[model samples]
Target: MSRHSEIKKTVLRGVYEDNAGIPRSTHGKRQSKFAADSQEPVHSSRYPGKAVLVAVLGLVALLGFNLRLVTVDVAGPAAMQVVEEQPLPSYRVQLPVPVSPVGALIPGNDQLVSPEPIQSLDDATITSGRYDTMLTRLGMPMADLFNLQVQTIVIDPGHGGIDPGATGHLGLKEKDVVLDIAKRLRDKLAVTGKYRVLLTREGDRKVFLKERVAFAKENRADLFISTHVNSLPPGAGSLNYVETYYFGPHTDQRSLELAEKENRDSDYAMGDFREVIARIGDTLKTEESKQLANSIHKHLYNNMKRRNRGLIDAGAKTGPFMVLLGVEVPSVLIEVSCISNKAEEARLSTPEYRDRIADYLKTGIVDYLEERAHRRTIEGGIIQNVAKQER
Candidate 1:
């Protein structure tokens, strides 16, 4: 009994101390409310715990529902509005574009435009003038011109077919006369075993001067020789002459005059005027050409006939001769003899006389080869011997 009483007294003392700071009336009210609540709380129902858990679950569900909602934006610009919800572009392409007008493909003036205006014959003067101006521009001459090792030789018999070269007296056609002579020369040259010769026309056929030059170039001819017969008034006495022509400039004025006369076909053919002038000018300055002409003339004069006109330095002559202009190789027009003279024409018609002329030409060619070979040997250089064979 005493122990129970002591325990109760301790409990009462602690409760009194806890409520010591509170007002007496409030402490009495709390104690009375707790006593009433303690009387009913003998067993816990757990209903309040269940309700609090339900409230917490409801708040979590609300937050989750708000987070799942999607957001959309109205954008500016039609192009932007069409974009998807991605970070990368949907298309890429490469396109070819037309080129704008650029600088002139031709050198010099820069303002040259594409689809340029069509130039009339007169309007094209500037184009031609440009070529003329190139003369003063100065550049290295063609290296092949100085290179002596060219291997091909093309020979053109002046007239053939409908276009008979020079008509001779005594019912002799110029075409037939020159063809016979060319054949003889070809045969003689073939015997030397030096060149592989090509005739522009093998038989009676008209070959344009342009076509002749083209043939030579196509064959890569190192030399081009056009053979023809000359004509003059009566009483000129049977005369035979061998002349060598280069592009331009005469060692003597007479030589120049002869070249000009021989090249007069250029005017009839309407050849390139500017190119003709330039080529002639350039030929005139070449020392090798003068030597070549003299060498050929010398051989013909000595072997063929003492009266053979010696190498006449035909000065640089200008002509529209189509064949001459087209040739990229050393070229010459050989006017063998005057067919107008009765004696010479009679001689030309004979196979024996033609063979003789061929023999003389062969000798001259041999001389030329021998001299060129010696020069090359002395220079310790290669000699590119042009080759011409008959047939």
Candidate 2:
């Protein structure tokens, strides 16, 4: 080949081909062309490996960035999803957050606060101790507590207003007589200033039996005394007597009958009242009332000088009388005297006789209080011992 042709061939080969073949004249020509064209020439010797290294590094960086995005997409977006059904093996996907530890729970603001890292509900056992503590703190009233000296008493007057209870043939009503007696009783009780006495009716207003009981409960009255007059069946002599009644779950028939009659209004006959009484009869079935009745019965008989019916042995019965059922306190009904009998009713209408009854009741109340004070002294000792042991 001619030298010029050989040089051209070598130049073309050096321009396009890798460092496999080369000639001095061709290399010079290439360098001269590059210089004249004002183009920067690359040093191929160092560039190829560098290019490969850069490509490999760039590929690795792209792969790492894509992996990071994928991980975030998998974990970050579904954190708040609720698990509606129990997780089965197939469905048990790992959550981003792990279950919180039980040790994280600490009391805050008088309540338990979870201290452990919270991830799920499966971490700790729920406790009822908080509720139990609250209930323990909410105990009985200070008045009923033996350590406290507060005493509560409730006074109930039988019949009022339109219900002219037990109208004797002499035109005297048991309602008026009982009210007069109640006022006098209140006055006498007030003079002592030791008992907290509440009257069921302050005026000639007719309060329902339930209302009387509720009044006692709302005030947390310790003792409930309902004053009324008695009525005897036909052919019985016009004898004067005082009767006391207490209520229980299943009281004597005579006790039920007496409570029913005394509670009856003029508008309703005995039959109608009995039906009304039947529905509520079971309410007073608790055994506590029997003790209450016994206490009142014992005091009344022991204090009063009048004809004693000797407790009537009614044995703490229950009936549907509004006044007795549902009264939380110890309750008793006092039939001071018979208003149905003409002579007895006439005497009840007199203020002097009413005052006499009031005086006798006041004495009974004092005796009951004295007994209660003694009992409370004993109970107080027991309670202190129990509290110390509990602590």
Candidate 3:
């Protein structure tokens, strides 16, 4: 056979051997070198191993691609950021910082934001800037005016002119005694430069109850204090004491009779007093006047008792007097002493005693005003709290 025929026979022989599940080798073959080499047997096992290796590599590559897709940040690009963590929700409230009255609560963006946690309007705080007070936000001034201090005081010296009032046995006239006291008190208050003190009558002149009230009203007095001396009836025993009276219905028979004596003038009738009382609601005016009376009586009684033994504190009482009628401000009628008593009349006759009494009255008034200012501060705080809650 020719070499080409020999090569074809070698390939066909290998195919037939492989198909028949037989192993073929070139070891004993009698053929040319090319035919012998072509007759080498193919290993089916090796082919299957290479195929498996390729399939496994392809599967691994697919799995790796799927894992990359799952791990990618598709939502957004990575970026650097700084942020304040939001606080947990809370209903905690903190008291606002106490802002003094030295400066008005300026309604503007310039005011500082309260670092204190506050219950905000919409329950969430604005991260942009500070929070302003409700009043400031509304552009309303602080109600400091509502918390007023005692300024102008009207001192009415009772029983001037035709009315001599009660005269002591030593001829110590109630009008003269009280006028001196009022003048001394006015001077004392004026020297301090804290008050504007005015008298209804400067000298031993006549002044009607109506005129006195009108003077106080026209001047816009913050307080009205009428000074007087008390005397008992013929049968009543001489009593030495201090008494303070506020305008109201009589608290007792003695008060009623005293009111009658003080209300004798023709300026205001019983009907007029009735009208004034009817117009009053819930006795607020009466309560305020009573407070004034109590304050004065406390100081007057305490101070006088030091010098005058057995000096009684008859206590603050309510009595309707013409001088106090229709007077809007906190008013009181103080019976500084009893002219009916021999010792008290003797003391009233002296200038030193009168000066001392004036000093006591001044101190008492100062005490009342100080207490009132403190109370007003507390009330202002409450008003602020209410305003905060409302906001």
Candidate 4:
């Protein structure tokens, strides 16, 4: 054997001698060679773990800082927005200072005046008599604080010429009857000299609903009264009565039907008037119109009752009457009598009955005007007192 083989055998002999193994000669030589041929062992250093932990912490810190900046940037403008959306304050006026009392004696006068004639502040009197004269000139009620005095009245005779309203069994036309009544009313009111009465139509002629309302506005009327006659349909049982109406929502089905009937004319249908009526439906003089209707209705019912024993009082109703729209004044429609009924028709045909209606209607107008004047007197006094205090 060579020297190298001899060295290896020597190492094996030592290993076998120590362990007393039988195969140590070949196995020990192979094991020593395999161990010598292997690579060097690697060692883990503490710096690598520390470096990983530091890098993770740095990344976490950077993310946390960026999140804080995002939160502030998003929330800052929203916070400012709330502060910017506030309303401005309203304006206030400065009031005038009160004045002191004047000297008891007249200025530039040397003569000694009686102290008894000089009234103290506590003895100052507030007389309403002065306001009454001013209120009367304005055509306002003298006794009421807020009342309108009637100066100009417009009497509208419903349906004329081409439009012959409702017809009676006795050949009496509604247009003719109402026109005569209107003329009589105009004449009666003219005699008073207190009111400026004007008729919408002088003779039997076709007058549109719009024209009637326009006339009242053009004349600057304080009150508008439209006269008409009520009639029942052929199927409806005879309903003979006197009723008054003001422009408003219909009170009942009957009032609506009556409004529909009265609104119909040869020149225009219900459709045309509806749009016009709706346009001017919001009336500022609703309360005044109601008062006028009630006043006229009461007098009509009371006066007609004396003449006709079985006169039915239908009371005041509210209906959308085209003639009453856009009047710019207190307006009412008076259904004098039921021309469809034989007995009522006979009465309406007579001159005496028409004259009676005209008289009662005039009385109602005068009463309303006087009451309004009385109300104005009270209002004027209050306003005068306020003016004096302000001064």
Question: Relative to the unseen true structure, what is the C-alpha lDDT of residue 98 in candidate 4, on a scale of 0 to 100?
Answer: 18
Instruction: Please give the CA lDDT of all the candidate structures.
Output: 0.48, 0.52, 0.64, 0.62
Candidate 3, which segments miss by more than 4 Å at Cα? 1-145, 278-281
RMSD each, Å:
47.2, 40.9, 42.3, 44.8
What is the alpha-carbon lDDT for the whole of candidate 4? 0.62
lDDT tens digits, residues 194-222, model 3? 89999999988777778888999999888
| Candidate achieving the largest TM-score | 3
TM-score of each: 0.52, 0.53, 0.62, 0.59
The candidate that wins on lDDT is 3
Residues 1-391, model 4: lDDT tens digits: 9999997996775454323311111111123333564554433231223344346435644654221110001112233344346522211111111122222111111111111122332122112322332222222222122334567899999999988999999989999998999999999999888888899998889988778877898998888999999998866426678899988777788887888877764356556656755444322255457656766886788778777767788877678776776576778999988888888888888999888888888877766565545434533433343333333
- Model 3 residue pairs with clashes: none
Candidate 1: worst-modelled 10 consecutive residues by lDDT:
382-391
lDDT of 1 by residue, 1-391 (tens): 6999997995685354333312121011122344645665343321223344345435543554232211111111232434444432311111111132221111111111112232232322222213323222212123322435635667788878877766676878778877887887877777667788878889998776667877887887866767777665466545444454544434465454444455554444233445555544432122333334444444444454543343222222222345565675556665666677676677778888777766666665555555545433422211111000000
TM-score of 4: 0.59
Full ranking by TM-score: 3, 4, 2, 1
Better of 3 and 4 by lDDT: 3
Q: What is the lDDT of residue 386 in candidate 4?
A: 33
Better of 2 and 4 by lDDT: 4
lDDT of 3 at 83: 17
